[model samples]
Target: MMRLERGSSRLYAMMLILAVVVLLADQLTKFWAVSTLSDSERIAVIPPLIHFRLLYNAGAAFSIGAGATWVFALAAAAAVIGILYTARRLASTGWALVLGVLLGGAVSHLGDRLFREPGFARGHVVDFIDYGPFVGNVADIALTCGCAAMLLLSLRGVPLAKTPEEETA
Candidate 1:
């Protein structure tokens, strides 16, 4: 087995911590949504703005490809795998945080898709937070924030440890 370097441990810890936080927040909020809100019911937090509206989505955002729930589940699984595969190389705190959020959101939604309702891999995601026509859960927000962070990090030249060849040059 390959031993992890000391600094890499920091990356692992940051990723795991953020991932767990997002997972718990997403799942707990989803539980609250299912228990409290009636299907398609909206409770306005701010009129004409934010609201809590329960919904079950069997597809990706905006119900796109509504019949492809299984595809999305697989996609989420792939994301989890990819993050784990690359996480060890994350040297910067910013990179670790960004990837952590992405990993967490992916795992949270994957849980719902795998175990919620309508059977495995076909289960719908419980979403309640509504911003006008757009409705989503904590996972979606985390994913969005993670993506935005990636953009910023990239623009700022997200660090890449020098390869042996580059180091020699």
Candidate 2:
């Protein structure tokens, strides 16, 4: 295992960049989807593998809690705040990257929930990019992958706590 200094500056910088990139990419793609694709329209990019489509989801994953968009928005906002609060204890490179993407994804969805269409705090999220029967957006992809990475890291016993030096600080 590579020894990392407590409260590593480099890790934090990397995490910040990753977070910005994820957020920008998610929003930009959604903008592109809205401008280019009609609702429920699909354009196959690869046979049986990938396609582009436009969908508005006013619910959580798989359309769960379909009528509780505002509740989801509030939950997402809280998650973002919680992640930032825990970031100070971040130590591993793996954890940093995962958390960064998670934060970006959460915040991006929160933005859509707050600002995108039908009404405030109950706006639907713009989703595109389809894999067979599964449709999701950039933020969803990032969030899924990040969560998977965190799970794997945990399984491998990667510690997320700060070092002794950081504890003293």
Candidate 3:
């Protein structure tokens, strides 16, 4: 287990808050889509650009592995566990925010897989927000942005945890 430094509570607080907010936004939007939108009809938000088209995807982007919902569920569960484990050593606020977003996306997707239609661990993810060739939900957006930011941070050499000497400086 990693030991937390002084003021680490603030980092945890930020992470938790961001995660909850993202989760709520993703779920609420999906709820609204299910309640108001139709799988057979599309609502145009921007002609030929963006729109809302309800879809239950049983696979990853582009509907890859359409027959393997359980596999995706397992992957999402693993991602959630991994993020939580890494969060224990977080020292940078940016990393905290990014991980929180990633966690929220992963958890929301996992919830859908565990509770939505079809069956447990075989449920399809609720996807909307059509973008010409793609359709996905807020959780997907969060995950994409979080991953991009994480890559940027890593490229910049941001440490996940502060060293003992750095803590004293």
Candidate 4:
């Protein structure tokens, strides 16, 4: 097994912390939405723009593949695994942060699918915060931001880790 250097360890710690924060925020907000909001009522935060409404989504974005909740659950599990695998060699702080947020959101959704109502591996995701087009939860926000950051970092030619050739140079 490749041991992490001190800096790499610190980066991993930061990533873990960020992921925990995102997971907590997502869960707490979902709890609040479930307790306070009603499915039948839309609480407008900004008239015709933003609203708070309870939504139980069993599928991916925009309710696509509604009938395949298990598929989404499996996909999320696979994504979490992939992210963790990538983290093993991470050498960039930016990548650490982005992956942390992404991991958190993915884990949150996976948890919802595995544990929350209906049945195991077929539970619906709790979502609120209507953005005039789609309703999503905190996890979605984190995922979106993380993805954007990932894209930006990639565009800037930031490497996730130093290649063997680069390290020797």
> Which candidate wins on TM-score?
4
Residue-wise C-alpha lDDT for candidate 4, range 1-169, written one tens digit per residue: 7566566678778888899999999999999999998888899899889999999999999999989999999999998999877776677999999999999999999999999989999999998989988999999999999999999999999888756564445
Per-residue lDDT tens digits for candidate 1, residues 7-65, read: 66778788889999999999999989898999857798988899999999999999897
How much does candidate 3 score in TM-score? 0.93
Error of 3 at 157 (Å): 1.2
Which has the higher TM-score value, candidate number 1 or candidate number 4?
4
| Model 3 poorest ten-residue lDDT run | 1-10
- Each prediction's number of clashing residue pairs: 0, 0, 0, 0
How displaced is residue 71 in candidate 4, in Å? 0.8
Model 4, residue 127: C-alpha shift (Å): 0.9
Q: Kindly report which residue stretches of model 3 are placed more than 4 angstroms away from their true locations once superposed.
A: 1-3, 163-169
- Runs of candidate 2 with Cα error greater than 4 angstroms are 1-6, 163-166
Q: Measured by TM-score, how close is model 2 to the native structure?
A: 0.90
Q: 2-114 in candidate 2: lDDT tens per residue?
A: 34445665666667678889999999999999999997688989977999989999999888887999999999999998877666667889988998899889999999999
Alpha carbon lDDT of each predicted model? 0.87, 0.87, 0.91, 0.91
What are the per-residue Cα lDDT tens digits for candidate 3 across 21-127?
99999999999999999779998899989999999999999999989999999999999999877776678899899999999999999999989999999999999
lDDT of candidate 1 at residue 100, scale 0 to 100: 87
